[model samples]
Target chain A: GAGVSQSPRYKVAKRGQDVALRCDPISGHVSLFWYQQALGQGPEFLTYFQNEAQLDKSGLPSDRFFAERPEGSVSTLKIQRTQQEDSAVYLCASSISGALGGELFFGEGSRLTVL
Target chain B: AQSVAQPEDQVNVAEGNPLTVKCTYSVSGNPYLFWYVQYPNRGLQFLLKYITGDNLVKGSYGFEAEFNKSQTSFHLKKPSALVSDSALYFCAVRGLQTGANNLFFGTGTRLTVIP
Candidate 1:
């Protein structure tokens, strides 16, 4: 792909249902990040991955939120027992630089709505 | 902690007029400032960043941001506004905050360019 790609552009999940969103980052990107953007709000950091290592996840709202990048190129964010407040656009971004100060390439994002 | 603030919820400007979106930041150490634009239904695109430079940084789409250390502000400015430039603008910052190494974004400002 020419840029970061995310799947399931829209998803409606009943309360308590589990949902998974996927992201495919640009080739050779060293860092991948997950963010949650509620309606009318800026994106908030969820987690960060450097290769297969999960370095920072202090932003996850709760234990129900989980993310993984097994192979480092593709990543998945799984939400268990989704709640109404979980509804937001899940954004995935990648950067060639691992530092937080560098520019990042972002995907279109997957919108998740929990009823 | 590190955080950014965008006080304006909406900004209106006439087409071809100069526009400015204000942003202020609070961080632990030095600040890594960035500006991003998000069009409807699309992911955020990076505009520019101020790492360690001449305080003025140029980015894509003829956008520039001035980093002011005294005021702790980084404002995005454009000499001429365009209809296509009407979008949500976000300011983000990263700092040496303990156990926090991700960019913290502001609420965002909606820019509307009247034709």
Candidate 2:
């Protein structure tokens, strides 16, 4: 892909419903990350992956938030029993290297509106 | 813990005039700073980063940032503002220590470039 791609640009879910968001990062990107952005706020780290390994999941807000990058190319974030407070934009980013200075390329984002 | 603060929620600038977006960071150790911009329905684009080099670092789209160690600030600046530059700006910081994989982002600043 020319750039990072995400699916379902917008999702409206009732409270307690389950939702899934997908991300296809740029080809050959080694690091994948997920973040959450509330209205009028900056993005917050959710999870991180290096290749197929889930190196960090400390940022996941709760056990309901689960992310997987099984193939190291495509990733998915699943949120179970969505709550109204979960209404926000979910962002995915990829970096060519996992180094501290690597620049992360982001996706257009998947907006989840829980009502 | 590493965190960033974007003091201004919104900034308005006249086209062709200079523009500035402020950011301050806090970290236990040295910090790796970065600036990113977001447009409507689009992903965030990386502007610049400050690692271990000089204070001023130039990035894409004629954007630049100054890294101030004493003041703990890394402000984004553009010599001339353009209407097309109107968008959301974010500042992020990461600790330079080992196992610091996630970047903490500020709340973001909305920049409106008036013509």
> Highest TM-score: which candidate?
1
Q: Show model 2 residue runs off by greater than 4 Å.
A: B98-100
Chain B TM-score for the candidates in order: 0.96, 0.95
Worst 10 residues of 2 chain B by lDDT: B94-103
Tell me which residue pairs clash in candidate 1. none
Where in model 1 is the C-alpha error above 4 Å?
Answer: B98-100
Give me the candidate number with maximum DockQ.
Answer: 2
Q: What is the lDDT of candidate 2?
A: 0.92
lDDT of 2 by residue, A43-99 (tens): 888999999999999889899999999989999999999999999999999999899
Candidate 2 lDDT over B14-105, as tens digits, reads 99999999999998788889999999877789999999889999998899999999999999999999999999999998886534468889
RMSD of each: 1.2, 1.2
Displacement of residue B51 (Cα, Å) in model 2 is 1.3
Give the per-residue lDDT digits (tens) of candidate 1, residues A85-110.
99999999999977757788999999
Quote model 2's TM-score.
0.96
